[model samples]
Target: MDVTVVGAGPVGLVLAAELALSGAAVQVLERRADPDEAMKAQSINVPTAEALDRRGLLPAAEQVQRELLERVGSFAGAADDRPPGAGRPAPERRFTGHFAGMVLSPDLVDWSDPDLAAHAAVDGARMVPQPQLEALLADHIARLGVPVRRGVEVTALEDTGDGVRVDTTAGTVRTGWLVGCDGGHSTVRRLAGIDFPGTDPELTGYQAVVDIADPEKLAGGWTWSTRGAYRYGPQPGRVATLEFDGPPAGLPHARLRSRGGTPMAPVTLEEVQTSLRRISGADVTLTALRAAPTRWTDNTRQAAAYRSGRVLLAGDAAHVHPPFGGQGLNLGVGDAMNLGWKLGAVVAGWAPEGLLDTYDAERRPLGAWVLDWTRAQIGVLRGDAKSAALREVVADLLSTRDGTTYAVKKISGVTQRIDLPGDHPLVGRFVPDVWLRDGSRLVDHGHDGGFLLLDRTPDGAFARLAAAWAGRVSSVSDDHATPTGVLVRPDGVVAWASDTTDIAAITGLEAALHRWTGAQTSSPAHEPVS
Candidate 1:
């Protein structure tokens, strides 16, 4: 096998598919015979959409047939009072001070680059069912001809000198690398002996998805009645979800059981319907029920090393946490995307092994940042006096353009700026969507498999840099002149950049390249800027 991916969930399937698309022979081992039945993650953010789009999977994701509601309104206390639809005059807002945050529907946001902006607009989140998403990705992987070995478990893994030997229930297999896209409890992570250090939330959450006749009544986006403690969302068609803070005893009688169920009275569809009626004052009829236990763990842990020789961890295998900010699935997909290109390059022999180390360095901090912010948001949702006070400030800030921008950036993941600092604008920041001097959009580089150098000047040093890397790097010159040149990683991040075409002015280009490619290559000789 070119790559062995453990687990066939959305993350695993997506990773295998991405690697397959990049021409790597991949195999995915999953214990389940098919996809999971329950709907887990229901949202995708801008960065995630952009990542999927790069692999031409955005259209498939959209084809899952989910629609977004235009607005999200929050409530404080349960009220039986019913207001008219959006067309009618507004009723007195009962939870004026209790409202936490509003998530705008995705339709209102621009998604010109369907992949780039998949979750770009509509309050930094898009509502999509996890089952539907997984099914769609599974279909894509099948279409790509990647083998998904369902009902097979990876029993053991041994790192061979040159590659990895994977022992699955299906039999023994050999691969240049192995990726752990398995969920929070990943066998691959364990096999690699990676330590996952993080804190589990003291609180537990219960969610039930049911088929309701009047889901549309609850369909104006999700409403948080008890801050983060309790929430509800209406899915397209007749599906609706009710989630609440778990009791001290835990769900279906404590002891922290699996979604499969425990000894206590099983959570039934009638219970879900009854809970909905009690909370929302709507007598909803339930057709089906899916119950699960959830926790808000802020464990900001990543693998001590993303890769140990031939085995690598991606997605939940790398990090695990609560889904407070809808970052769980998105973060996993990001890990897949970040590792996909590098793995592709190495397999194709375009780059050396050292490039893989940057995956941990670059992504670990991002995981930590996400964990911190999500924890803060969860704290806000705890609904204590401090949280209430903070919500008021946040709500007020959300009303202004700047506040909206900040909130949107935070939620949508557009604000992720890498900590690579230098004088260049692209340094320590995400490469912005800029027009090249040649009138081509930076987003249209059309090379997703290798490093791209964007220089405005037709100079020798720039050419020399590309020449030194040869097939590993591709050079693109902007006909219109600018002083600086930018080098973008395969994942669309700026790795090395400069403000002047003198090439010599770009002091750290070589060092940056070596750091990015993980190759012990010599840096381009350049004079230090005084």
Candidate 2:
């Protein structure tokens, strides 16, 4: 196999699909016996939605997700106490994410800015369950003929000079590269000998579905106490409680063991009762426990290095943080996107030196930023008087126009800029999903997983030069835009753009192509004259 991807979750499936689409032989190994029905994160941020749309999977995702949205009423993160239709038609309904306990609302952002909307690309959020996302990706990879094998646990890995030898429960397999997308406790990450370093848990969080004897006594929103914070509903029968008292002593783990669970135990109704009693001094009784309660912590850590020889890491295997703002899946998806095409290029023998290294260079900083973003929130949500004051101030700031826009940009990842070599402001930015005169979109041209050239010059020289790269690059005639042409990479980043598609512009485009995709053999008919 060209690539052996461990963990058939969204990240691994995405990488596999990209590699397979690019003509690489890929296989995915998963430890899970089957798909999980438990709904984990339901919030999909704008950037992740846009990434899916770029790959032509968003339509399918939306087809399933739209029904969920309509059924659930899609009012997550909106003001609960709105004065009955106060705002102007709700401005396309961007979902609310939070920095800490403070909610980051769509209403806070100015969606009218053309540049912001252009950067948004797909222009919405998705609220799909974890299983749905995994299923969607699984179906996509299946369509692409990428095989995903389940009930296979990778126990060990050895990176030979030329390839990686993976030893699983089933058997040993040799592959050119390996990627670990397994969850926070990643077996592949441990086997590859990567050091995971970061802060420890500050608090313990509990969540469960229960039958409350007195549901009316419990507030239906987030509440802060001396011990910690908790949120009761938006979901009836579901309760989430947090405690900053300390790490679990033994009760939580013991309950999990009694129920035949693992060390990172599932919370019990008794545990929830104890936590709530201690934190809120509430004597609310439970009629029945419908589901097993689960325990988590704000335990944060990230791998010291994403790559070690031919073995790499993505998703929770690379970084793990508190589930603040629904960033884990989104961050992982971004990692897969950044690494997939680069890996495909390397395997296809067109990648320049140091191309793969950019994965760590680009993604590591973003991971660190996310870690700090969550940490900042954790600090203010500390359930203290000082922290409460700080939260109030920060919440007020987040409600301001500039503050809201800044938060939106950071959370949505729309303003994310890379530092590629170019004087054009959009050089390191994602290329807009520019609509052409032909009734097609710029994103449509990227479906083949190739670089796109939007040529609108009087002479067709730029288009001819683009043809020199053939399968590595594609061109579309856009007799519309201001710049003579725009060069977009397979990942939808603007590699080069010019005011005019002259001889000079063609020379620059070729150089840019060489910089991004390496040198291609030129034919006499397409080669530019110096």
Candidate 3:
């Protein structure tokens, strides 16, 4: 096998599908008999969608649902004028207005840009159930003719210098590479001796998907407090969640569904029902419920190395943090997408082993930032005096267009620009969608799994470099002079740029390629004439 993926969950499945699509012979091993129950993580962020769009998987994921705007249930703003007859008897208000909570906007790169639109459409995040996502990814992998071994567990792994020898419950298999997409408590991480140092689960939240006759009437965000215990939920539909500080004795482990393993007692549906009734005046019937332990961690820990010889780690196996901004699944899928092309390239013998090292360098810092921001959010939810003050200040600042725009950028992940310093606008920024005069778009540059140069003019340097690299690089030059020429990496970051006709003024294209791709080619002595 070209690659062996552990744990056939959504992350593993997506990674397998991506690798298989890249034309790699992939095999997936799972401990579970089949897909498990849908528990958490239903919302996909804008960056996640953009990442999927680059791989052409967004459409299939979007088949389930479209973008979901954040809703505010009961928090009100300070309007100058009060409601009519405020002095008299007033109607009871359960919650306030819609503009209270945070809003994550769409990606910065517009879909209308012809070059980018054709390559990838900028669809906002989709809200699909986790189980559905897993099933779809698994089906996509099967369609690609990749072998998926269910009900099999990887017992041991031994690096054979050339490849990895995997021992599983079903049978023994050999592969050039291994990726662990397994969730927290990951067996792969343990086998690899990776340490997951992070904060303990101080807060526990209860989530339930219940059938409500008047779901529409109960829609919006909610934050209710009872005896200092906070339960916030009813995020715009029938799904209601209750989050509270864990009891001093700790929560009793109760299995709400078969998906989450069995645990100790003290937790039950009756207790959840009582809590819901106390929180909300309505007597809501319970359909399904599960408890999720939220932990605060660095979110930056990797295997010290992504590849220990031939074994690698991706998704939850690589990093774990609170699911605060709906980033866990997205982060995992991103890990898959980033590794898929490189794994394919290495397997095909185009890229050297050193290319894999970039994964940790680029992604670890980004992961740490995400963790820091999410921890700040958790602090706000915990009602820390400083965090509360900060929220108030932020809310006041958000009254302005610029402030709101900044807030949106921060939460949406569009602001996450990779630091690749150069003259080109596209470098360090996501490749913006370009509207070609011919009316075609070029969003899926990663389809071929190589570096792409979008030259606005007839720059011979880019063409020459592409010709020299052959199958290892791709270059496209449009007749029209777009604002700037963009160089996109296999993972979709703009690696190089040439804003003007002076393509030779900057470092040679060969040097840029070698730097970005970790290629060992000699740098061209003379810059080609534009």
Candidate 4:
């Protein structure tokens, strides 16, 4: 096989699809026998939604079939139901989620910036649950003709110079590359001897849905108490509680010390009620526990390197943090999008020497940023007088136009800039969703998993480069106001663009093609340029 992706989660599936799109043979190994139905992650942020859209993997609005959270959810402030602008008739602005349990109101956010707004074609964040999202992604993978082998756990890996030997529960397989998307307790990462270093757990968190005996006592939504915080569902049978009382008490006996000396434990209904009572100080009782209660800690950790020889890591294998902003799934999806095409290039024997390394260089820092972001949130969620006061101050700031804009930009992943070397303002920034003269969106071409050259006036040189690159690079003739030409990578980041299609422009385009896709040494299989 060309590539073996461990863990058939969203990230693994996405990477497998992108690799297949780039003509790489892919096989996914997942330990789970069946798909998970729990609502692990409930939303796809704007940037992640765009990433799915670019790949044509985003399900239709009607197909999502879930509640549309037009406004972002936050724990920072109380929920607002006034439609952001108090029933005003203007650009609809919704809350942009929250930071530190405070809601960042949409009324305070400025969506007036044309450049930023250009990246906002989708309605808003979609509230698709984990199972539904997985089903949508599984459909996409099925269409790609890739097989995701379930119930196969990766046991060991041996890097044999040209390829990696992966030993799984079912059998052994050899591939040119192996990616560990198996999550935080990644076996591939462990076998590769990669160091996962970060902060230890400070608090234990619990999430579950249950039949509450006394639902009237506990109010819907968030409640901050001296012990901790708890949020009840809008209706009965949903509850989440958090307590700062160290690792959860009464862990099932099957845990204490697992492999690698890390602690492991199973959460029970009794413990859930205990935590809830301690945090909320309410005599809330559970009639029946519906789903398994998930117990996690604020134990943050990240792999020191994303790659180890022929083995690599993405998703939870790469980093783990508190699921404060629902950034975990989105971060993994982004990593897949970023690594897919680049790794595909290398496998096809045309990638630049350092192309694979860029995955770590570009994504590791973002991982660090998210870690710090969650850490900061935990600082405010300390459930102390000082933390409460600080959270109030943040909530006040988030009630302003400037504060809302800044928080929205950061939380939405729209302004998460990549550090690429270029002179154009668009370089290393989110590609604007510009409208082509043909009435098609710029993101439309990105589905093919190839570089895009939006050249207004294409000549023989541009045509020749496109021909030489063939399926690797695609060129489109369009008249756009921002620039005469734009070169976008497969992941939708603009690499090179020029104001005119002169000889210098052509030279720049050629250099950029080489820089991003590596040198096209094959003889030109010329395709006519429009």
- What's the true lDDT of residue 118 in model 2? 78
lDDT string, candidate 2, 1-530, tens digits:
99999888788988898888778899999876776444345567666777777778766765555555454344244333333223322444456566775666677687766556675445433665566888888888899999889888887889996999999989999999999988777778888889988887767777676788877777766788888887775545767777886657654311111211123544567888777667666888876666656566677788999999999999888987777667877888888888888899888888853788999998898898888887887888887788889998998999897888788777777776677777776787777657888787877877767788888887767788777677788788878457778898766678898886567777788789788867665662474558
Full ranking by lDDT: 4, 2, 1, 3
Please give each candidate's TM-score. 0.75, 0.89, 0.78, 0.89
lDDT of 3 by residue, 429-471 (tens): 6666665656655565555456677767554545555555555
Off by over 4 Å in 3: 66-121, 212-219, 226-237, 240-242, 247-268, 271-275, 278-283, 287-305, 383-390, 444-446, 459-461, 503-507, 517-530
Each prediction's whole-model lDDT (CA): 0.60, 0.75, 0.58, 0.75
Q: Is candidate 1 or candidate 2 better by TM-score?
A: 2
lDDT of 2 at 213: 85
Better of 3 and 4 by lDDT: 4
Checking candidate 4 for backbone clashes, the offending pairs are 72-95, 72-97, 75-101, 75-102, 76-101, 76-102, 77-102, 77-103
lDDT of 4 by residue, 1-530 (tens): 99999877889988999899988999998877877554366566666777777877654532452233322223223333444323322344332667876766667777875544766665333455555678888888999999999878877789998999888889899999999997777778889999988887777777787888887888667789878888786324667777876765554211122211233554568988888888877898887788756776777888999999899999988998887767888889889989999988888878853799999999998889998998899888887788888888887888888888888788878777788876777778667787898888878877877888776664434656666776778877665455777788887778887776667777777778778877665775543223
- The clash numbers for all candidates, in the given order, read 5, 1, 18, 8
Off by over 4 Å in 4: 59-62, 65-95, 234-237, 249-266, 458-465, 502-504, 521-530
Which sections of candidate 1 miss by over 4 Å? 21-23, 57-136, 139-144, 160-162, 206-209, 213-234, 237-271, 274-284, 289-305, 345-352, 383-386, 436-440, 458-464, 481-484, 505-511, 514-530
Model 3 residue 377 distance off true place after TM-score fit, in angstroms: 1.0
lDDT of 1: 0.60
